[model samples]
Target: MSSFQNLKKSRDARRGKPRPNTSSTSGTSGPGVTNAGDGTYGMDDELASKAREVLSTALGIPLGQDEPGLEFLDDPEVEITNVSSYDSHGRKQNVSPGIDNLRSKDQVTGKGKGKVKQPQVSNEHVRKRGKDEVSHELYKSELEGSGIEVHTLPGKGRGLITKRLIKAGTIILKTPPSISALQNQHFQRVCHGCYLTMKERNIASCKNEKERYEKKMRGELKIKLNRCSGCKVLHYCSRECQLSDWPTHKHECIALQRFRKMYYKTYPTKKQDDDDLSWTQASPEPVRALARIIWKRRVEREKNGGKDGIWWKQIASLESHVSKSTQQEVMRLAQQAQHLQHYLSASIPLKGSDVDVGEDQLLPVNMEDFGFEDVQEVMNFCSSFHVNSFTLSSPSLTPIGVSNSPLMALSNHSCDPNAIVVFPNGAKYMELIAIKDIQSDEEILTSYIDLSCPYDIRQRDLKERYRFQCDCKLCEKSKNQGVDWVDPRWCVRHEGCKGGDGKGKMPVKGSKGVVSVKCDKCQEDFKVNAEEVLSVVQKGVDVLDSDEHRQLDYKTAQKALSTLIPNLQKHLPNHSYPLLSLLRLSSVSHTPPQSPKDLQIASKHIKQAYEACYEVYHQNHATPTLILCEYAKLLSLQDSEQTKMVDLSRNIAMKNTIIRNLLEAIEMLTKAVKQSEITFGKGFVVGKELEGILEGCKEEMERLKRS
Candidate 1:
C-alpha cells in the first residue's frame, strides 16, 4: 500500500469507528442498531455496554439504561476507543492496546513487512518512573558541579541542599527557562527574544510631557520597535533578535494572527484603532506559555520518534496541585482551558486536506496530535503553570514576564530565605545565588513572594496564591514573640509613657469594630474605633494609588503630602507602613526639585523613607539598597551654591554641611554598591551603575577638598 493509504488506515484504526450495518433495514440502520441476522450482533451489543460502563466510571456519572445521550456512543464519527484504567498500584493508565497512531511507517515496520523489535527496558529507566527518583536524578544532572543535591526533607517534599559550604554571593545554579513569555501588557514594550524592555534598550517613549519636549528641543531621534510582520503584536529591538526568536515565535505568530482575525470576525462592530491592540491582549501570559509548551512538545515528540523529550519531562515533573484545587480554582482553570481550546482550534488545520496552509503561514500545531482527551488535560497544564511559574525579571529585578524552570522550582519558600533567584544576565538565563552563607546539608530556600509586605499581608498573599501558610523561621518568630519589629502597621508612639525617656510604643490591637491600645511603659489603656483609624488610613492609601495623585507637579505633590502625612501620623505611628509609603511618594513626586527649599524637603523625605525601609527590609535586602542609592543621589545634589544663606557664619556652616553631605553621599554610595552586589548579583548592571555613582561622588569630594 502507498504511504498515504497506510496513514489513512492507521488514523481509522485509532479512531476505532465500527463499520455500518448495511444488511439492516433503513429504519434500523442508524447508530446503536445491529442487524439481527449478522453473526456479530451480540458482540457489538457487549462492546457498547462495556464502553458505556467505562465512560460512566471515568466521568463519575451513572449511565442509566434509558440515558438520553446513549446514541452518540454508536455514532461513527465519535471515537471511543481509548479508556482510562487503574494499574495494580491504583494509578490511572491510558490503555490503547494497539499500534500507536503517531508512529511513522518506518518506525512501525522492519525488513520484509515485519514489526520493529522493541528495545529491552532497563532497571534505570524503571527507577526513573518513580517521582522521587526522577526528581533526584534531574537535580543531580542539572546541578552536577554546583555543590548542591536534591534531598527529601521531613516536611518538605524535596529541597535543594548544599553538599558543601556555599558562601554568600556564590552562584549556586544557573538554568535557562524551559518556557517563558511576556505578559500581554508588556508585549509591545519588551523584546520577544531577549526580554529586554524598551526602556532598558533606551528606545522607550519619553516618561512625561516635559521630557518629550526636552528631547524634541534637543533634536533627539525618537526610537520605535520592529514589530513582527505576521502578528503585529510582538516587538523586537533588532532584526537579529527577531531572527533568533523565529523558532518559537513562528508558532505564536501564526496563532496570534489567526486569533486576531477570529476576534474581529466574532465581534464585527468592535473596531481596532491603529495603535490599539487590546483585542489581541485578551489571552493572558499563561495561555501563551501553555501554547509554547504544546508546540515544543509536538516538535520534540517528532524528533524523539514518538516520545516526549527531556524538556517536557522536566515540566511534567512539577506539581500541578490539581487534586488539591478548590472549587473556585477549578472553575477558573476550566474557563482558562476553554479559552485555550478556542485559541488552539483557531490556529489548527481545517477538516479537509484540500485547504493547506502556505509555506509562509504554518499552523501552530495539529490538535489531534496533542492527545488531549478532554479540557481537563488543558486545565491540568494551567494548574501546573500557576504553581511552578516564576516572575521573569530584568537584571534590575523588575518583573517583565512569566517563566517556568523546573530545576529552580526545587527550592521551597521561606520568609528568611538563604538563597535567591535572579536574572542577573537577562531573562533568558536565571541564577540561583546564595544570599547568606549556607553550611553543608542546609536546605536551600527562596521566597516565593515579596518579603517587604507586613506579616498579615504576606500570609494572606501566600495563602491566596500558593495555597500554603509559611512556617519559616521569620513567621514562627513573629508568631511566638511580637510582630512589632517585623510589622509596624499597628505600632504607635505614646507621648506620656514612663519608659525610654518618656517615649515608648503603644501596641494596638483591633477586633470587630473596636481598637484597644496600651502603652508598654505607662500601662495606660486607650480605646479607638477601628473604622475611624483604619478607614482613614485606607482612604489615604487609595488616594496615593489614584492616577490623579500619581502625576502631580512638585508644588501640588508637596501640598498633598503635607495634608496626608500629618493626618496619618496623628492616627498611626511615625514610621508606620502607610507613613513610609507617603514619604517615598513625597521623594519621587518632587523630582528635579524647582528650588533649594524643594531640594531640602525632597532630601529629608527620602532620608526618612530610607530609614523606615532599612528597619523593615534589613541591610542586605534589595529594597534598602534601592532606597539608599536614591538617597545618595539626593545628597550629591545638595551643594553650597544651592543653600543661598546671606550671613557669613550661616554660609560657612552651610558650606561645612555641604562638604559633610558630599562625604556622607560618598560613603552611602560605596555601601550601596556592595549591597547591590549581594542582592542583584556580582557584576550585574545595578552593581555597575552603583559603582559608577560612587566614583562620581569620589570625584566631587576631591573637587570640594581642592577648593
Candidate 2:
C-alpha cells in the first residue's frame, strides 16, 4: 500500500538517508522520514511518509503559519534541495529556480532550467496538474448520488464499488474540506483555512443538459442564498445541490451549526454511537502518530514565527520565506520531534491488548482549548481515544470533521487488501477500486500491503505496529505454519497426508477445499484437512529470528529449498517465504562460482525471485531487491579475456532504465513505508538490495555511457 510505503520513507529519512523529491508530488510535504522494505522501486519507500506529511500541511487542513511542521525553504525529501525551501514553483514574487537538471539527481526542480542530462536520467516530470481538489461535477454529482453504489455483499459488508471505471485524475467524491468561518462572518469567498479563494471545492462542469442549465442560472457556482450564519465557509452552486446535500448532512450540519465556533462533542446519547471497532489496532497507531506529527509541525511553525497547521498529505512548506534563518530553526525543531517519534516507536514497550478510551477523551474541541483546559484529556486523546477527524471524504480528498467519523472506520487491515482505495492527491476525494473480481458474497478485503514476509515477522509487526491480531481468514490458517499457506503447504505432501478444505463448511471432517485443502495429518478421531484448514488463514504475522533456525542444516536445507520452492509458489501468493528459500538455494548454485552455467542459473533465480517478490509485495520490497543485486553481479561478470555475453549489451543499454524502473518502484514503496514509520516506527529503509542496486546501476550506467 502507498500509505505503508510512505511510512517506510519517513523511517529512512530519520535514518539519515536523503529524502525523495517532494516537487514530484502535489502541494503537501511529507512528515515522517522513515524507511520501508519492498520489491519494486529502490528509493521511493524510504521517504514517502515524510513526503506525505509535507503534502498534508500543504493542502489538506486549515493551518496557522506558526504551526510547527512548516517554515523550511528546502523540500525535505531532496538531498540537494538547496533552493530556498519549498518546491520551486510557488516562490512568491521572486524569479523561480529554473534549473531542470537538479531533478535528475533526485532534486526538486529549481524552476527555470531547460533540463538535466546524465547517465541514468536527463530530466524530471513535475506535476503541472492542479492540487487535489473537487471538480465542479464530482462535488455537484456526489451530493446527487452520482457514482455511489450501496449494494449488498456476501461475507463482507456492503460492497461500495464504482458505478463506472473512473479515470485516474477524475474526482470521484468531494465534500467541503475543513472549513474556517469566523463567528461573525456572514458570506465571503476565502481559503477554507487561510482562505485562499483559488482553492475551490469540487467546482466542475455539468454534463447533463438540465443540470448544466440549472447550474448556469443558480445550480453550482452561481447559487445565491442566505449566508451560513455559523461558518459561512459554504457556497452552493444552486439550491438544488444544497438541497441535495442537505438530506445526507442536515443531521450533522445542524449539530455543527449550534456550536458556533470550532467544536467537538461526544454523542449525547449512547444510542447515537454505534460500536464500530475494526481498526482499534491499525487505526489508533497511525492516527496517534499523525497527531503527534501535527503537534511537532505546529511547534516548529511557532519557533520560526510561522503559524502552521497539520493536514494529512505528502509535502508542505518547510520554512519562512522572508527569513531563511528562521526556516532552519523551525525545521530543526520539527525534525527533532520527528526523530523522537521514530525512536519512541522503535523503543517503546508494548502491551498485548487494546487501550480503552475514557469518555472525557472522546469529545472534540478546539485543539487549543483541549490542550489548555484539559491537558489530561488531551493526553488520553493522544494515547488512544478520539474521533477520526482526518479521514478522507473520498479516498483522495478529506472533508474536515467528516473524515474522522465511525462509518468509515469499520474496515479492517490486511497485508494484501481485497479492495483498493485510491485518493489521488492524498487529501480529499477517493475511489475504492476492487483490483480483482470479487465474488458475490466474499469479504471485500484490501491489503494494507503485500504479505510477503515470513509468518512470524508478519504477525509480530501487525501486533506491535498496527496494534491488532489480524483475524482475517488468511492470517488464521497461516498461523500454525510459519507462513500464510493454502491447504497444500508442500507442493505434494508425504504419502499418508491428505489435505482437507480449510473452511468449516466441509461436512466430512476429511473433506477439503480446492485452493486450501488440508493434509492427511489425522489425529485420534479428527482428520486435519489441509483444504478445510486452508480456508481459515491467519492475517497477522509472527517475527522469526536467527536463533529459531539455527538447527537447520545449510547443505540439506539448500537441497530442500530447491525442490519445495517453485511448487510451493504454484500454491501460494508470489512473494511467499518458500519462494525466497529457492532464491537462496539458487544464489549458491556453483562451487568456485566462476562458471558460466552457475552464474546463469543464479541470475535466472534471482531475477525470478525479484519478479515474484515484487508482484506479491510493495514495489520497494527489500528482500527481493537484495537478491536482484546479487543476480546483477553475476550478470555483470567479466573474465577480462572475452566478455562472454548474456545480453550484456542489452543489460548495459537498459541499465539506467532498469535501475530507474527499480527506483520508481522503490519510491512508491517508500510512500507506504513512511506511513508505517510515523505510526509504527519500524525502522524499514530502502531495501538494502535497492540501495546496493541503484548505486551499482548508477556506476554501471556512467561506465556504459562513458565507454
- Candidate with maximal lDDT: 1
TM-score of 1: 0.68
lDDT of 1 by residue, 7-71 (tens): 12332342343321110100000001111111011112222223211100011112121111111
Tens digits of lDDT, candidate 2, 110-229: 100111110110012111221113222222333355444332222222223343444322333333322111111212322222211211222223323334345657734432232222
Please report how far candidate 1 places residue 575 from its true position, in Å: 5.0
Model 2 poorest 10 in a row by lDDT: 92-101
Off by over 4 Å in 1: 1-132, 198-225, 262-274, 349-368, 371-373, 482-490, 496-531, 540-562, 581-603, 634-661, 700-707
Judge candidate 2 against the unseen true structure and give its global Cα lDDT, from 0 to 1: 0.28
- TM-score of the candidate numbered 2? 0.30
Which residue segments of model 2 deviate by more than 4 Å?
1-376, 383-411, 414-416, 421-433, 437-444, 449-602, 610-707
Overall local distance difference test of candidate 1? 0.50
What is the lDDT for 673 in model 2?
37
- lDDT of candidate 1 at residue 658, scale 0 to 100: 71
